[model samples]
Target chain A: MLIATALASVFIRDLFAVIMVFGIYSLLSAGFFLNLNAPDVALTEAAIGAGIAPILMLGTLALTRKKWDPEPHAKKSTHTPLLPLIVVAITGAALVYATFDMPYYGDAEAPSHTHVAPRYIQESGQEIDIPNMVTSVLASYRGFDTLGEVFVIFTAGIGVLALLGFLSDGSGRKYWQFADTASLRRHTVLHVIAKILIPLILLYAFYVQFHGDYSPGGGFQAGVIFATAFILYTMISGLQAVYKIIKPELIYWTMAFGVMLYGVTGLVAMFMGGDYLDYNALDHHDPIHGQHMGILLVELGVGICVAAVMMSVFFNFAGRGIRLPEDTKEGGQ
Target chain B: MSVVLGLFNYWIVIALMMTGFYLVIATSNLIKKIIGLNIFQTSVFILYISIAKVKGGAAPILEEGTELYANPLPHVLILTAIVVGIATTALGLALIVRIKEAYGSIEEDDIREKGGTT
Candidate 1:
């Protein structure tokens, strides 16, 4: 059934059908995660994978024409995808072969288990008081990666905003009026849900932010969840409502603030006579305690940036309709 | 027999992953490509879950006097991946909608034609 669904997703010509199949594929993948004993991961996959991605894709579909009408002249390249396909297959085959050499399923003796993971699992509780090893790994031990990921999201937001001309003053102002008021009123279900969930989601985000030393949640998940709530609001209540809540200037400023928070935290550590981002130097406290404090602050920065970036991207995309180019004579004037 | 079952499942999932990836990279249709991406991602999820299963082990949830339980880490990792996948898809679809409006068709070739650039 999974294989069939996958094939159908690829071969199907209808854009809408293809998007729906992709959603099914994500749903099935979520089921697979449940089988693996990762409820946290399963929840994220189900919510983001099967639920949000498809909706966003569908919304894009609505903006564009439904039928895929390729020009006949463009059909001349019959063998275009062949070379790339072959290269991909070879790489995949190599990957599979490499996997065979990996430790067998659930082997407690696997190298990964023997390596830093065991140390993380054994020491993190004593050091950081976090029961969730992944959270500890993500927030403290490998906090730099999370910072980079946050920057990636921030860059993506800026890219999208620039692409849609939302960076310019006139274009940005005009774009705010993109979503029709009728559509905004029609999606009352999402509006009500967002109204109810946004605060809870923000609260949970803070909990995840601070509770990282003890639980399965952390900055990344919390950030994404918080962003989702805001995205939901924008989707239902429209760009105008979102603008009321978070103006375009605030979005840009918050994004910068997030990055600066992370940077200054590191800089402060440097000023305190330790290396960059050395949380252990925050005070005269134990290195581990300093690390804990640094991780918390950094994760908060990450969460803030990610949430802001995601909202900015959604607004930039959704707000595009209002800014029909002046030269095109289609500005809906 | 059990080993064979495991190997077979792995092979099938890998094959499905390849096919999905091929379609995604090969197809000019934006929607079809997203479908292919979904298939590819789902295959990875399968690979992770399959690795988590212990042949005779019970579910990972601990209970009174239950000693054998499958691993839980992979499931957690896959869950995170799924959320990331969904976010990417949502953003991609939203992009597609904007693409359609700007260029007038979801077909890659047509959009390129309208824009006069690939």
Candidate 2:
């Protein structure tokens, strides 16, 4: 099924169909992760890959669909695909051939299993005392790498803002006339359901955030899920209500504050005489407690930054002031 | 037969990767290219998780009485990678939007033929 979708998406020119099928590809990826005994990874893939990424892609299409779709200029089909096919086939054959030397699938003695993973699995029980060893490794054993990951996304968020921040075409609207309602009047059911679902989604995201220490979700999944609640509300209820609630300025502040909190937690650890990001010093009475405290702090920081950044990016993308069909009519009225 | 049973997963994932690679190189549509990139990425992720699989192992949660577990390292690594993948995708899509705005078309051939910055 995953293979079929990938192949279909490759040939499909209808951008909307391609995005939908590509979402299926990601959902399949999540199921693939679950079959391999990686539920934590599966959860993140399902949420971001299938859930948020497609929505963002669709939001983009909403703006550009007018300018690009339905086979404009039929002559451009002149490009031949034979050269790329031969190249991909050779590269793929090489990869398959190299796999002959790899350890058999599911071999317990595979080098990846033989090394650091064994320690993470066996000792994380006592060392971090977290039920989810993936979280223990993500937040404690490999804390520095996770810190770098947060920074990578932080930089990505900034890149998105720099590119789209000044994009408003200045129809002189003080804010989006999101509820400058034409299409929204028809979405009465959508508004009511969003009202009910948004709070529930936010509650689940909260559970996923703090409960991550014990479960499949963590800061990464939780943050995106949290931001998703708002994105959902925006899609249904319109951006005007959401922007009034979470000022654009507030989202930006929270984005920086989340990064600062993560950085400051490390500094606080350093000032207390432990290494940077050393949670043990946070509470010397019990190193385990310190680990818990430190993981909680960093995860909170990650959750905040990720949620804020996702919202910020969505707002910028959707709020490019390109004016949807109904939005364009608002100026005339 | 033994080799097929042993290495089937890798071979399939490699095929998927190549499909993505083919889409990236062969297609002119920018959105299709991004989708291709994503497919390629997800396949590589599957490859890693397959490596991390231990026969008869449980998920990596530290449960009582569960002695064998899949490798947590790749889960930790790929978990972050998945999020980073979206981040990069968003960045790429943002660039594509700007490209559309400036060049008036996302097609590579169009951009090149129109001779940029009209």
Per-prediction DockQ, in order? Answer: 0.34, 0.84
Judged by lDDT against the true structure, how good is candidate 2?
0.86
Candidate 2 regions exceeding 4 Å error are: A67-69, A168-182, A321-333, B116-118
Global fold similarity of model 2 (TM-score): 0.94
Q: Which candidate number has the best TM-score?
A: 2
DockQ computed for model 2 against the true two-chain complex using alpha carbons: 0.84
Specify the highest-lDDT model's number. 2
- Candidate 2 lDDT over A67-149, as tens digits, reads 45486857846458989988998999899889999999999998888888878887888888999988989988888999899
Q: Considering only the true interface residues, what is the Cα RMSD of candidate 2 after superposition?
A: 0.9
Candidate 1 DockQ vs. native: 0.34
Worst 10 residues of 2 chain B by lDDT: B109-118
Per-model root-mean-square deviation over C-alphas:
4.8, 2.6
lDDT of each: 0.65, 0.86
